[model samples]
Target chain A: MIDLPHSDGGHLSLTVKVWRQDDADSPGAFQTYKIDDINPEMSFLEMLDCLNEQLIQEDKEPIAFDHDCREGICGTCGVMINGMAHGPLPNTTTCQLRMRQFKNGDTLVLEPWRAKGFPIVRDLVCDRSAFDRIQQAGGYISVGVGSAPDANSVAVPKKIADAAMNSAACIGCGACVASCKNAAAHLFTAAKVSHLSLLPQGSAERKDRARKMVAQMDEEGFGACSNTNECQAACPANIKVTDIARLNREYAYASLGTSD
Target chain B: MGALRRLLMSSIGKKYVMGLSGLLLIGFVATHLAGNLLIFSGSEAYNTYAAKLHDLGALLYLAEAGLLALFVVHVLYAYWLVAENRASRGDEGYEIGYRSKQRTTYLNLAPRSWMAISGTIVLGFLIWHLIDMRFGLRDNVDPTFERYVDEGLQSEDGRPLFLRYERAIQILQTPVSFVLYAVGSILLGFHLSHGASSWFRSVGLETHGLGGPLKKLGVILAVVIGLGFASIPIYVWVAGVEVGDLSAAEARERARHVSEQALNQPVEAMTAEDVAPAGSPDSDAGD
Candidate 1:
């Protein structure tokens, strides 16, 4: 990923309101912090690191947030910036958001994803193990371990191939859940369904995949889709709500065609 | 049946219910609107359509029962969904300075956020409509409306058919009823606009090629149904077409005159054009 310069001008100073919680059982509140001389080139996560550095120097507990890969692909790092999932820049992840997006003296509010399904673990961090459980429910094909098959053997049409690839792009980011009005994980679950269901090899388990994943998603206590399309807007991977539609179609067909 | 229960009970399963039921209701609206449009064709045309429905006896009742069941299912599931969604959203909201900057295709919130309110408004309107129009239970009764309901289309003694067209015209001409119908029509339109696109999404048809057209179709259907129904009341009020407490023969003559004048043709010409199956009328015009 290209690191864009903060600006042609100078460094930006920002005031951030961040949610602070000791643990899952504790009630969280917003804490204010003023960080000065923030370079425009630094990513949003990098800006958070600067504040954390200052907290450590003062012998105070540093603010906690989640991040694994600084790149957008990992889907580990996410925060609701100014009420938007993954910050204000559309389709951009938190780690990919540069300070250049905000002007100096900007006051930004950052908070953990508030959802019944995604309980907050600590400051700006939530337990996302729900996604793993939902994924474990289906989200995969049972192929015997063997040498890779020839690429031509699949014989997927270009349109289907492109669709499958697009659906496969979802990184299981909780941004969809954060942005959704119901905190619904339909978009995320649908992406997994579409990715595999469209592939010829995954056809054997396609019916069960949709049913089991949906059952698991519901079990995780996510809300139903009202089709606000906010999930699509907030998704950093650019996954569309159409994947959800595909999941619905697949589920209906599966339920009708097979007892499983 | 167990599988059906599992599907309907789950989150996504409940969505499938919303999508399918919503589409069913949309179909009902389009058909209902078509039947309403028959008012312009005059009494004989409209009454013949209503008569055919009434004449079906048990089949008509069965269809009505099915429709009522659909309405109950749709509204109950929708209410349940709204509650579930609210619960999932949690109690905490963003701070005062927080604002959403995400780009969206449509700027209007009526179709997105006003769903519950719009749905409630439409539901209220539906109850009032059934009472006033279907059951003939309103106070200060137009006795002519009661006659239409009691007698099946026409009297056995060769009296003219008490055409539904007249009651429709009379009710629409009243100021309060007209306003209510107009508002109800518009609110139902808003509901349909969101509902149409949403149904497809709920069913998981989020493919790129189809989503845009589906969204557009939803808006178009909403406009057509909303404005089309509103046009009737507006037409009645503006034109000052009075169908005041007429005798059976007089009502028939009035119906024939309007139908002939409007189309410059006989009622048979229009009825001949209606190719709907025996009992359903123009319901199957399109999905």
Candidate 2:
């Protein structure tokens, strides 16, 4: 007998219309899955896990989805729930989304990020290596870590340090890509460029970072920023488009005659 | 250089090109509006202003050519950006997210979606405007600046005395032309209101603190300039002011009124004859 616990909150019944793709090249379709007796406090991924367990018992193909560090910190878990990246709740990730937010008999449609730059790997999983390549292009500084410097020695101003940390909060989830009409990676690129570029250690490579990261982003077939601002709206980390302005300023200065 | 080309090919670089070109076109429009506002001043002042521009000879043509080039760059790049944005959306759209009627705040949160439509209508109006006035295709009256200068305040055999002023009033009085001008100006207003500051933001020039003020300035400028152009056809049609029939005294009175209203600067009363000739030392002297 399966144990079912009914907590303070009532159990939720959900109908999920989820995209099912065997591989990147295979034709994909949506498969409907009905789940019942799910605790309202269960996270969105937990509900998915319950569905997968039932599928395993029935001797059918379980849904394939990506998740790591069920907490929101890792940025590994993301899916478009009802056409919104990480569901309708703003500034919340999929792993953090509780089932209580939805009512009974609510139908949810889930899909992977659908930008040309992000190729679908399997059901609910797209190859996000494009973002990694953009990061590797020039998202960091080449400062040689000879010896550990005292934290008080290279003291950054509180304001700049705060901005840097804020930008550093980007989890590299492709929500911005999924939400953008143009699928522009400007917000994501701006985050990485602004994060390290705001610090003293990252300042030395500021120009090169903006130029190279932006170039890589464009090369990856990402679209340009049309000022729609949906990326900022959908951002789970609440990263502002102000970083984009800073990136633009840095790029303009770099485009002029170079120092070396 | 390859670097410049590469920069232009980049998305942000293309935005800089659009921003710079848009600003250049706005400057030309401002100058054009100021000059056109002279129509309210009566024949002598209007014709004199038109004639002086003609006297610039090759300089005037150079400026015109530069303006045309700027227009081409702005329009072509705007089309490119729209096409690129379309391709980025992939094969399908969201089934539920970002519903059209949903309101995010008190102010409408949706970015103005009709910018491309408004821009295209304005572009079409521009071509029609050139065909109507510059080519003199409508009434077969010569609208050339040199011709206006030659016939200033002088009655030709069986023709209007104030050639340039008469032609302007006649064109403004036409119903079709008036409606087209009115609609075009409104569309242009919509285009400019969003575009002026948006270009800056797209290029990353607009900072957080300055965004609100910059947007306000853009909308204000758009309304002022759009209404300013639209007013010419409306005032002409309503007042039924005969440009060629005004006597010298009436002309002087109107010129003073135009200076006070349009320029917002009071000037000493001066007859048409009192005005210094073009290229005179006082006229050429830099302020």
- Tens-place lDDT per residue, model 2, B50-147, is 64565465898898899889999999988998788777766656555432212342233332555778889999999988887666676543343334
Error of 1 at A59 (Å): 4.8
Please tell me which predicted candidate would have the highest DockQ against the true structure.
1
Residue pairs that clash (backbone atoms under 3 angstroms), model 1: A6-A40, A242-B206, A244-B204, A245-B204, A245-B205, A245-B206, A246-B204, A246-B205, A248-B203
When candidate 1 is compared with the true two-chain complex, its DockQ is 0.43
Q: Where in model 2 is the C-alpha error above 4 Å?
A: A1-15, A31-39, A51-60, B39-47, B96-114, B138-169, B172-175, B232-287
Writing each residue's lDDT as its tens digit, candidate 1 over B223-258 gives 999999988887788888776677744554444443
Error of 1 at B136 (Å): 2.1
Each candidate's DockQ: 0.43, 0.30
- Model 2 C-alpha lDDT per residue in residues A1-260, reported as the tens digit of each score: 11222344778788999899899889888889898898888999999999999889989798888899988888988988877788767788899988877877778898888888888899999899999999999987686745779768888889888999999999999899988877889899999998988898888888888888989988998887766566777788988888887877777766765731
- Highest lDDT against the true fold, candidate: 1
In model 1, which regions exceed 4 Å deviation?
A1-8, A57-59, A150-158, B96-102, B105-110, B140-143, B146-154, B157-163, B204-206, B245-287
